[model samples]
Target chain A: MQKVFEKPQALSDTPFAYCPGCLHSVVHRMIAEVIDELGVLDRTIGICPVGCSVFMYEYMECDMIEAAHGRAPAVATGVKRMLPDSVVFTYQGDGDLASIGTAEIVHAAARGEKISVIFINNGTYGMTGGQMAPTTLIGQKSSTCPGGRDAAAAGYPIRVCEMLATLDGPSYITRVAPVDPVGLTKTKMAIKKAFRNQVDGKGFSLVEVLSNCPTQWKMTPVESLSWIDENVVPYFQPGVFADR
Target chain B: MTTKKILMKGNEAVVRGAIAAGCRGFFGYPITPQNEVPEYMSVLMPQAGGVFLQAESEVAAINMVYGAASTGARVMTSSSSPGISLKQEGISYIAACELPAVIVNVQRGGPGLGNIAPGQADYFQAVKGGGHGDYKLLTLAPWSVSECFYLTALAFDLADRYRNPAMVLSDAIVGQMIEPVELPDKIEVNIPPKPWATTGRKGRGKNVINSLWISPDQMEEVNRRLQAKYTLAMEREVRYQELAVEDADLVLVAYGSVARICRTAVDLARSERLSVGLFRPIGLFPFPTLPIQWLAECGKRFLVVEMSHGQMVEDVRLAVNGRAEVIFYGRSGGVVPTPTEILDRIRKTYGRSAGVSHYRLNPGPEARR
Candidate 1:
């Protein structure tokens, strides 16, 4: 008997504090695996966002900095600029990246900062207990949008990958999901490619992972997976949004 | 090392000084008065093997400085009055994280976007608290182009030395005016290694984490330690230049470009047989209050000349402690008082042998409330 799947070397032994059936653990594993496989864990610096994963610095085996809400990119920009020879990446949630930190991420990418960004878009603010996120679907109901997101008032969901792809400075921009086995595998590939782009000095790269928030979505882990498969995937339509 | 005496604007001298000190990254947005600082860096940084970015906004520029500074690199950013206000939050965070970086403020008249003239209205904001939380920045106010170059280099040195943010506070006049500066011979100062930098947690040592933790005990400890560091900084870094104070009836206290004008005013007043001296504070924070107090004990009447409505006057009053009658003359909203104007005020107040007038000094909007 051999180990079919084991934790990546880049992750610590600390148990995750995420809710049961939350997909953040899986996403973290994927990033860790990529870092381990690339053998860049020693030279990689991670910037954690002020969301549920704010304590990610405790779990990630690499050097990490917990940034103020929506300031992970700016913090990452600082780390990258100071340590240009090192690989730098920021792990941010939709609320942190698209809402408050919008300017930071856009300018960093536009400047073609030679770093990677792992943007987790879960349609709702999971950390603050299911608040409506900038990427929330039109009809989605969260704590903030109790009556469902009204398109007339709240506007449609932001397609961040597409929006960032339009910027000339970014070397790569891709959208993926962890809703199903196929989607999860593709999301890992995208994450790996983002890191690879940085290693190759290809400039700014991003992989927006459509993650599951079973606790926030008011569904079991199994039901949340099904909801993502039926509803979220159709609207998001995951694929590579840009490449250079 | 090539050293040349050149007449250059204070803003341009700051840029050259940064480059000479081996600064390789500059991120700033354009603002009145101080626009030349970034413009000069844009043209010269790349030529000197550095990166110069014209950021979209002051906020973005400060964040960029945060980014570059985190890498344990010497980085800088500059702005005018209102723009510097916009950068306060980022500066606070930089201080919280104890990141070493330099910020230049070529102040203009303002509570908000005032004028493009020289003003020291931000004295309280710079020396007291410009950002959130209880923190202090190492602020140096330069009075001449040569001082601009010298202090900019000193700012980087002090920042790196203490692993804290340092500021070079200038005014539009000092930034814009051209003066002969004999560039100092570039000395090889050893920059302390930043083992705490987030370069990576490789085979060298454990990963370094820079964060302002939100725990009660942790926050208290952080604040206590910061207070201690500030105390040490105050004892070690207090700087000022006193002129003709050994025998004088009246002493004029000023800083930045206004101090230069006060120097000229003092020269003219001396010619008119007025026993007036000058006290110029180079470092605004950890202010040179001891010297002012010393002059006050000598029974010198103090007059504070400023571009703002007596902002620095409060400090002078506090230092004097009623030993000498402190008076003030100021013009806010981007107005620079001519040397003759300052001289006239000096004559009207002290030349009549009445000693000093005890007219109530308006506390301005900030102090009034």
Candidate 2:
């Protein structure tokens, strides 16, 4: 008998420390699978941001550089520029990429850096106990926005895939989700395409994964997945923002 | 078989030096005093088959350097005072990651965006850890256009040698002034393969990662190892050039462009029969203290003249260890002291007063000297 599901060879044997039912584990699996499929496991360097996936270095059996909060893009830019032949990718959360690291990511894409970015937009700061993130939808409640996010006060959610797609440098930009089996499968395809873009020497590819934060959303794992399907997916509709 | 000598500004020399050294990537924003650096690279880098990017902001430029350096490519960035401050976070990250790259700071007057004039006010910032954390940058202070070219090449070599960041600390005057420079031969530079680089993990078992994280114990060990490397660097990399110190009564210590001014003052003081000498530090970090102490033991009075208000003077005093009177003459806030002004001070201090006698006569030089 053959196993239908197993950890990717690129991933270490260490069990993930993510909350049970958190979609981060699923996203991580997809990325690891893509790395294995692309055969870029050895020459790939991943930059982990200061968010939920900060410990990504330990989980991914790749050369990893842990960047300061929101600095994964800048660090990834450095890694990619220095090692042009090496495949570089940054694993960042919504807060890390859209808020504090906005300048880094924008300019990196604008410069058309030959790298890939796996942006995890979970709508809250997961590792820091679920503060409101830049992609937090209107009326969403987090520890920071206890009374639900006020668009007039906190501003609307940032559609990073669309925003970044405006830059001419990036060759590919897409937004995908992992709320259900079908969405998860689509998200995996997007991740694979991002890796393939880098392999083909296409400059700057990104796959923004709209994932569920079960603990932070104050819902059961099933409800969190349902919430993503009902709320997050509609606001940040899944599709390729750019492909050229 | 010899390299040709050409007249060029110090900023231009740095650009040529980088190109000749096989530097393939440059990221910078326009700032006074050193704008010529990027401007020259803009034309030359492309001609030399390199990348030249005029970034939107200093923050973006430094991050671009961070990106290029991460690739293990010979990359560089330049900025002025306030711009350098804006790049501190990236600088710290680059140091933490142990990336090899060159950073040029054509220092102008500052505690803020002070002025676009020549100043050595960034001495402490450059030599004593400009960014946070336990790390030191290999800093070189070039006094002339030739040194600018030579030191920029040295900066790349040193950065690659130690797998560390190196800085070329210039002043507005040095960056702006035109002087004849003998360009170095276009020797082939072998950029070491970064087996540890994060290109990808294709055949090499797993992907490579450049991170600053480890467990508490592991972090401590990493820091300890870094400290040991810095210590070794200090022992081997201390560099300075001394002039006419044998049997001298007064030794003037200075660096960068100010050192050139002090040299002229020393020449004039000798003509006036004051017997003054000069000690110029080339490598600002791992400062040339032993030679300074040796000069002090010869019973020569030391005067530290700088464009800043007595920053490097403190370093001189520390190196002298009270063996000789370490006097200071400085003009801050973008004021460039003339050679005549420094000569006048040297004459007033050393010519009129007889060293140890003056110390006994005047209890505090800050009050009376």
Candidate 3:
């Protein structure tokens, strides 16, 4: 009998505790798969943030460090600097990357820190009971913004890839959505490329993953996928903003 | 081998000491009273084949220290009072994760950006778990430039030995003052094996450096383990310098730069025919409580002098346990008390005359008012 597919060797047997229909498990799988494909599982270290995927280390087979809320980039920088030969990356969410940790992330990119960043922009704060995130849409309703996010009051959703693309430090900056089969394929490819860039000694590669939080969006998993295509995709255009 | 002595600022000695102690990574921000630390590290760290990064902020710098230390590398970060406050969050995480790192607080005046001169006001913030949560840093207080060089190396050893963060709680005067430091050209630092470090876990099971224990029972277990480690440190690492405390009627309790002044005041008090001694706590966290208690049992009075409005006095009072009178004389807002002023305070308290003993005495039941 031929074995067609199996779990990535870099992924552990631990079951994910993510909410049903969340894309965190998918992204985690992609990152693990990339590590296996690169054959750097033994030399790969991960930094997980204080978000829905805070336990991302439990699922990854490589050595991992859990950073404080929004400090994953700084932690990754430290790890990468100490172990220059090892592949280092940080897994963070919109809130973790754009809000409280904005200074850390921006400076990390500006310093041209040689590390990969996997950013999940799920529109709302999924773990914290659907609070308004920095990437929340103008009309999006969250626990904090009960009446929908007002652009004037809450400011605008941050386009991290676009913002980072403006800096010369980053070698690669891209946005990808995994709401469907085709999008999922591209998301995985982007994640792999981001990791590959780090392995090649390229500096500050980031892949912003446009994901849907079904529970937080107050919709079925299927409905949330469609909601992302209709509402989220247009605001956050999916493409490589920088690749150099 | 004969070790040569060099005249260097306390800030430069800290950098030199870290390098000598096998510190391979240093992440810091430029702040006054301690800027020279990062400045010296910037040139010396790379020369020593180490990493010296001027982080964007103190928060990022400490988190960087966390990341570097998680890999079992001897890493450090130095900042002043305001900057140290910014680092409290990362410090808490480092403590909780049991990461071995050295943090230097070359303290300056501050409740909020008070001034850039020297200050010992951060004593509470350092020894009392400045960050949220129940944790302790092996805090070392150096009274002179020579001690600054040596205690930093000791801090790295102790931090790694216990797998806990160690703080070099220095003041601006000690950080800036240039004095002769008799140090070996290259110290042979013996870093213990760190099987827990996250160094890619080659050919072994995956290693995870984390502080978050989701289950309450698990969290309690983690805290119990940390507390046990702290207890061991307290037993094995209590360091203090006692001068003339045996027959002295009044013993002055102090640390850091204030201790140096107290040392002079102790000499001056003895010259003035008063039996005053000095008890300088070298390790602030594992504070020399036993010695203070022993002194209190011998019916000795205490006068705690600090650069702040009385922070370490509380610890001294706790050690005394109301067994004897504990007086506190402090000067805040970057005012370094001269030996004469401390000597005068000592005379006022020890002489027991009714001639205006303005310093607060007996930090217990009747002294609350």
Q: Which digits, one per residue and each the tens of the lDDT, describe model 2 over residues B1-369?
A: 357767899999899888888888998999898999999999999898888877767777777677677666789998888888888777777777788889999999877879898888988888888888888889999999988888998889888878788999998999999987777567567677776554555566553334455477877776787788788888999989989888578888999988999999989878766678899999988788888888888888888999888888878888889898888999988999888899888867844474556334533323433
CAPRI quality level assigned to candidate 1 from its DockQ score: medium
Error of 2 at B81 (Å): 1.7
Residue-level lDDT of model 1, residues B1-82, one tens digit each, is 5567778999999998888777889989988899888889989998988878887688878877877787778889999889
lDDT of 1 by residue, A77-189 (tens): 76676677788999999999999889888988898988899999889888788999999998899998999999998999988888988899999899887877888888889
Candidate 1 residue runs with Cα over 4 Å from true position: A1-5, B1-3, B351-369
What is every candidate's alpha-carbon RMSD to the true fold?
A: 4.6, 3.4, 3.9
DockQ for candidate 2, C-alpha atoms: 0.57
Flag clash pairs in model 1. A78-B67, A82-B71
Candidate 1 chain B lDDT trough over 10 residues, lowest sum: B359-368
For TM-score, candidate 1 versus 3, the one ahead is 3
User: Which tens-of-lDDT digit does each residue in B1-369 have in candidate 3?
Assistant: 347777889999898889999999999999998999999999999999999999999999999999999999999999999999999999999999999999999999877988998899998889989998889999999988878888999999999999999999998999999897787788778999999999997979999999989899999998898899889998999999999888788899989888888999999878765678889999999888888999999988899999999899998999999999999999998989999888878766644632424322433212321
Q: Indicate which candidate wins on DockQ.
A: 3
Candidate 3: residue B234 lDDT (0-100): 84
Off by over 4 Å in 2: A81-85, B188-193, B207-211, B351-369
Model 1: chain B TM-score relative to the native chain B: 0.92
| A188: Cα error in model 2, Å | 1.2
